[model samples]
Target chain A: MNLRILIDRFACRFSAFLSVCCVALLALIAVGLIYKSWPILLEHSLSELLFSTIWSPMKGKFGFLSFIISTFQITIFSLLIAFPICLLSATYLVELAPRSILKIVLPLIDILAGVPSVIYGIWGVLMIVPCIRDHIAPFFGYTTSGYCILTGSLVLAIMVVPVMMHLLIQVLQAVPHELRDSTLSLGATHWQMIKLVVWRKCLPGIMATTILGISKAIGETIAVLMVVGNVVQIPKNLFESGYPLPALIANNYGEMLSIPQYDAALMFAALILLAVILFFNMASAYILKRVTKSIT
Target chain B: MMKHKYFKKLEEQFFFGLMQLATVTILFGLLFILFTILWKGIPNLSWEMISQKPQGGFYMGGGGGILNAICGSLLLGLGSTILGLLLSIPIVIWLNIYAGQYSRNAVMVRTALDMLWGIPSIVFGAFGFIIMLALGIKASLLAGIVTLTLLILPIMVRGMDEVIKTIPKELHESTLSLGATRWEMATRVILRKALPGIVTATLLGFGRAIGDAAAVMFTAGFTDNIPQKLTDPVASLPLSIFFQLGSPFEIVRGRAYAAALVLTIIILVISFLSRLITAKYQKHSR
Candidate 1:
């Protein structure tokens, strides 16, 4: 019995140590990236690095203004496109769809979410890019090479819909049946109850979901990189080619490290990406915590 | 009043109609993507493509197949999934068993994992590359597996954590009351109850590991032959498709679609298997 207790104590300590290691891993990543990027950080002021647009690496200038703008433009536009559709789809699933439809649609969403990002990249290259070039762009009185910010946004919007809709459905379903019934008993129509009660209750959750989606979108590399044309410019319109931070790192890191500070500039970009995503994730977590607390 | 009521009813109907349309539109987009891949890929996806490795000048529309990439991807996926599982299970066991479920340490760990999950796979790749540089290691299969393991660890941990949280509290109490030590209870009872969930989480990590390209792009240098040792360079299906689709040759582009079809089928099979496992094991749980 004593031996068994001893073994249990040892296991407990070992597992606790492992858990501590898991937490430490995050700090380690942050520190490693900072240390690697320190050289570039020392050479340039943070404001200049963020705001300047001249990106001639061989000449030793690394302005990141264009990449930052493009990242924001693509991410915000995609979220604008995906949020409403996800909200509407979740409402339909929770309030209107029959059990049989739910059974099918839920699994479909999971499969869609599971589809690889690179496959989405392939599909975007083959379908969305061409469709935009031949049809959508022409209809809007502009001609594009089928690779632009709009193409990236459209593909990303689709890529994010399944995950966002899945979460929204869960949030909507968590509304108490009694709350819905009470609203209906007051003679409000179905949509009215949804607008007044259900939507109101899920507002924090929806906000959190949107923030999470933004984090996901900004960090996506291969799919957006494949379609965004990789031009070093701030896009003036949806049809214009642009570059984002993740794309910049993925496209140029290995081949160009021979240039002085090139590796450090790339590492700095990675650091910025890491910091932005961490902020958004923490914000979402805070919102979600409030959501659970108020519910209980 | 009658006119106002009529207007409100019309508004409700209008918005409801829009909801249905949005749902249909999303579903149609998914089906259209699958259809496009099948239509373009099926004719080119031959038996030889899966069985034979790429031959000379393959990117220039040469003969042979992507057997190297297929095997390499499978090997990397399996390696990383096993490594991730070994790390994740202990972290989760500590979270649910040693630390109370709502303890401060548990919350801190969850937040760290959540932040880690939001970091892009590309960032993971970059960080892995940094580590390799520090250690004076070249891009190899081992490097790829390490990076992929970091990329998928949070996913597996959170997934398994959710599953273990669902196990009834009474079960935990009963196991301890039967004189089972904490270690014995964890391995013999809780682990048994959560076996199906653990498998699903493992497969989820495997799917992500195999499908990811950016995380392995720099860490796993592309090669024509499968690696005979951990230190050797490796190829993967996503990178294979990326390189092939980038080719100007139409034949190579066709092969990209074919390779994509293979990747998609693998993911679909995993999702289907996980569902089946969940249904089968749910009856055994409380």
Candidate 2:
């Protein structure tokens, strides 16, 4: 008994230490933010960093709020385009698809996940832009210019399809077989059972997953930067190119000189983005766990 | 009874057809995108093109070869992945063996790691540039490698943590019952069982690092030739593609397509290998 107690005690202590060490990933995030932004902080006071609206990197003015708007506008639009398609495809795959077809479909999605963002950018620039110019632009009275909020939104939606699909498929597949089993066993139609019972049980998990995918889309930089055209202005139309916080840094971080505060403002953006993403992730994880456990 | 059975068969066929169509739509969409570049770009690919930097003239002339860019990506990716793993392994072990059941205490830590993972690679690019300036690393491979370590460490640690946590507590108890030290159990038992999963996590992290362009763009700078020393400036595929696409010339743009295809193929092969490794080990070990 004494030996058993010692063993258990040892296990508990070791786990705790491991937990703390793993947890330092949080400190690394802080280090990353500070290490990148401290120069900006030292150059500009906190108040100026948060509230200022001037963003000339060459002359040393750094405004973060405007980029924040671009980030949200692009993110929300992408999620709108992606969420429905992904949900429908996932719904079909998890609830309705035959296994032979699913075996092929799942790996195809995996292949999509593996494609690099730069390739996506290539598609966007070469195909998407011209399509917009020739097709979508005339309808909207803008021709020959394809880089804008909508293009970013469209490409991002395409990029996010797999991630959202993967997460939603996992959650939807986990919905108790009996919940639907009983509903269907009652002679309810397939669509009706899915709509009324399976969806109701899986709503929280779906919401959590949706929010996580949105946060990821928001944090994206390379693909968006490549295709978004980096024009620095508030977009009056979806087709007009504009910069977000991520692209702003991507375009100017290396070129900016002696502007420590400019760097700090970039950190401010990082901190804001980090905070929003963390909150979304935490909420999503919490909701998923609760949903999964409650039914189990 | 025969009539009713015929209707049921019809219903099954209708539903199966719809599902198959949905499946086809998604699969074809992704495949079309993948093949678009390779189809358009492959005719332009050649050994001469591979040996030179992309320039203003046709595909055959000017600039320099991508020999440097490929080497840079491999070096930066491998170096950072190795460094990040070394730094985080002890943490994973500690959390698995020592944390006991009170993991909620580590919630903030895990949350932090997730935030890092989500911080757009561009944001890291911004921050990495700051550190490079601060330390005077100055667009060198060393700076890029260091920045990538920070970007990838959180992911590696979290992935490994999840795998380690999945090790049944019984495994720990049994190993310790053999009169092994806590460290012995960690080194000899828990880690050995979890090695494949840990390796999977590392490979995924490495792939993410290699495919990443925005994070390393500012820190690594653009060098077209392979570096003979760690301190030298270097370019990567993503950066090369980015700069090429951003160029004013159309020929350069086409070459960008070619390069993008090469990078995608590389990424696809890496991902398939990771999937194979993970699936193979799990199937055999179980």
Candidate 3:
């Protein structure tokens, strides 16, 4: 009996220690990344490494300007494609869709959300890439392989649509039913009611969702890497091939061992990506907290 | 007034039509992608593809199957899921049963998890690589398992936390009033109440771990054979697809699609099964 009590005391202490360890793990990742990249950061001028477009790590030049620009371009392009459609679909689902229709549509979105990114990458390779190469790129007079920023953006847009839509739908639904009824009773048309009442009220929620979508698009690796021609140059146009930060690390991390400062450079890239993603996540969380608090 | 009314009606109809079109696009896109994968992949999938290990020159259309990748993926998923559960369950228990719902520590933990959840898998890979370098650990099954554990920890914890939070406080108080220790309350009462949720969370984390390519790409060095030891390299389905699709051979590309089809089916089955389980059991909880 005394041993059993001792065991119980140990169990309680162990459980608390596990959670504290998890929190420490997050700090460990951040510190480890910075520590690993310290060699490159110490040797290379920070401005030259970040601002210059040249990125031939083979020759020990390591400017990430091209990749950063491309990551932004593709992320913005995908957000442009995803935002309007997601907003409309979400609004329709919240304000207009019949219950019977929602039952089907909601599940479909959930399934899409669950579909793996690697599968999305494969599909992009087969369908979106070819179609862009044959049909879309020609219209732009861009002549090259099908892999380009446009193709990557299109695939990413598809991947993020379900998630963006889900969040927007929830935000829209969370605008109290009484608010909708009040707006309708004010002689506003259904569209007007949604425009003035629902959209206006949920703008912060919408911002949160948009930030989440941007973060997802920016961080997406396999699908974007599969389609984004991954040329180490800043894209002059959407039809041109360009590299992004994640793709650069993915494609080059394996070969870094043979190259000087390559691993450090890639670690720097990873750090940058982590920083951007964490910033967006924190912003969204802050907004979501505010939105939820206000609602409550 | 009549003109304005007509314009309002037209505007509403137009936007609603566009929304409908967007919804259709989402559904159609999903269906088309699924159909295309199955259509292109099914013909290439044979019993050998599922059961046999890849032979030499497999990526160049040589003989052999993706058996190594299939097993590796299962092993990684299973290992991570078990580890993730072991870590997350205690965290969930601590938050609900120990820290209480409104504790400052609970809020911080949840916020940290939210931040962690938003991190991309590639970042995890890089972090894992750094840790591995520090520990003198080579890229192996153990490295992959550790990376995947961190990757899925947030997902598992958050999922199970939400579920545990739904268990009414009255149950906790009543159980405590029965003179049971907190450990007993956690193990017998809280665990039983949240078992289905914990299972769902495990399945969710497992799905994420199995499907992720970026997190395991560096840590789990790809090999054509299953690892005999934790220190050996293991191939995964995502990395297999990534490698195969990168190959120049038409036959290898076909096999890539076949592998993708397999991975997709596994994820779909898991999602469906979890949903069914949740639906079946959640009814009783309420």
Candidate 4:
């Protein structure tokens, strides 16, 4: 009995130690990224690094304008594609679908969410990319290969739908049933009640879902890399090929060691990626806080 | 009155139709993907494909199989899942057991984890690469495992925390009133209560770790052979699909689908099983 007690005491301390490590790891990563990126920041002015548009790492000219723009362009375009579909489906799940249907449909969505990104990339390569190249791009009069901004955005939209829809479903489910009941009692139709009551009530959360979806879209690496033609330029139109931030880092990080300051520059790009994701997440958190406050 | 009623019914029907269409699209997309992967992948799959490492010229109508990637992915996934659990379980316990439910510290930690969960896998990969350079560690299984551990830690912590949160406060108090230490109460009561959830958390982390290509792409260098040591470079199933799909040969492209089919089926099974486990435990808790 004494030995068992002693073992428990040791286990407690060990667990506490591990818990502390969990908190420390985040700080360690931040410090390491900043430390690695310092050299690039030192060599170039902030505007020059962020806005110069020319990203010839061979010539030591590092500008992230094109990539950053591409990232936003792809993200925004994908969100535009996903927003209505996700919103409507989420509303359907919460308001229209019977419990029996939901039990099956919800699990299917969950299963889709767990599919790996690489699998999506493979699907994009085999199916979506060709459809874009052969059918869609030709209609748009895109003369070159089918890899372009539109292809990446379309693929990304498909990937983000499950995530955004799941979040929206949660937000919609959180709406007080009393609100819907009261609205319906006031001679409002079911559709009218959902639009004026549930939708209005959860607007902040809905907005936050958009931000969260954008964060996911921006951070997507493999699927974006496979379809986005990876040209280091700001695309002229939706049909033109361009590189996004994550794809750039993945494509070139391996060969970074061979060039001067290239590794540091890539680290800087990563830091930018990290910062954008963090910024969006913080914004979403802030919005969610307001949402709960408004509900109460 | 009749005209207004007709318009109202039409509006409702239109919106409902749109919502149903959206749901159908999502379901159809998922089925199509499954069909395509299985259709393309199953023909290329064989015992020889799964059991033997690739011979030379594997990408060019090759003679060898992807045994190396299969073993390496398992090693990395299992290694990272175990490591992530070591950190995640305690952190979850700290959040739910040690800290009071509504404490400020608990809220802060949860917020940080939410942000971490939102951070992209690519950034984690970059951070791992930086750490590797600092430690003079090359791209190897150890680096991949460490990076993957970090990648999945927040996810496991959050998943287990939610499970722990579902336990009633009365249970904690009753255990404490029995003169048991917090550690004993946690180990004896809470963990037992949350066992199914904890298993689900571990499996979820494992799925994420195994499926991720970006987090391990740089840290775990691809190799044709199975890793014999922690420091050896290793190939992963995701990267194998990636490389194979990028090949010029149609036959190799078929192999990519084969790998994707295997990966997707594994992930699907994990999701289904975890749901089953969670349901089983929910019955007990109720």
Candidate with top TM-score is 1
List the candidates ranked by DockQ, beginning with the highest: 1, 3, 4, 2
Full candidate order by lDDT, most accurate first: 1, 3, 4, 2
Position B71, candidate 2: lDDT: 77
- Give lDDT tens digits, candidate 3, residues B114-161: 888888999999999988888999989999999999999999999998
Give the per-residue lDDT of model 4 (tens digit) for A1-296: 68767866776677666666656776777788889989999999998998989888888899999999999999999999899989998899889999888788777877788889888887777788889889987886777577889889988998998888888998899988888888888999889888888899889989999999999999999999999899988999998898999998999877899999998898899899988998999999999998777757
Interface residue Cα RMSD of candidate 2 after superposition: 4.7
> What's the TM-score of every candidate structure?
0.99, 0.87, 0.98, 0.97
Which tens-of-lDDT digit does each residue in A67-105 have in candidate 3?
Answer: 999999999999999899889888888789898887778
Where in model 3 is the C-alpha error above 4 Å?
A1-8
Off by over 4 Å in 1: none
True contacts kept of 3: 0.71
lDDT, candidates in the order shown: 0.92, 0.76, 0.89, 0.88
C-alpha DockQ of every model: 0.85, 0.37, 0.75, 0.68
Question: Least accurate stretch of 10 residues (summed lDDT) in model 4 chain A?
Answer: A15-24
In candidate 2, position A27 carries an lDDT of 59
lDDT of 2 by residue, A41-78 (tens): 77777777656667777677776656777888899999
Q: Would you list the clashing residue pairs of candidate 4?
A: none
Error of 1 at B157 (Å): 0.9
Q: For each prediction, how big is the interface RMSD? A: 0.9, 4.7, 1.3, 1.7
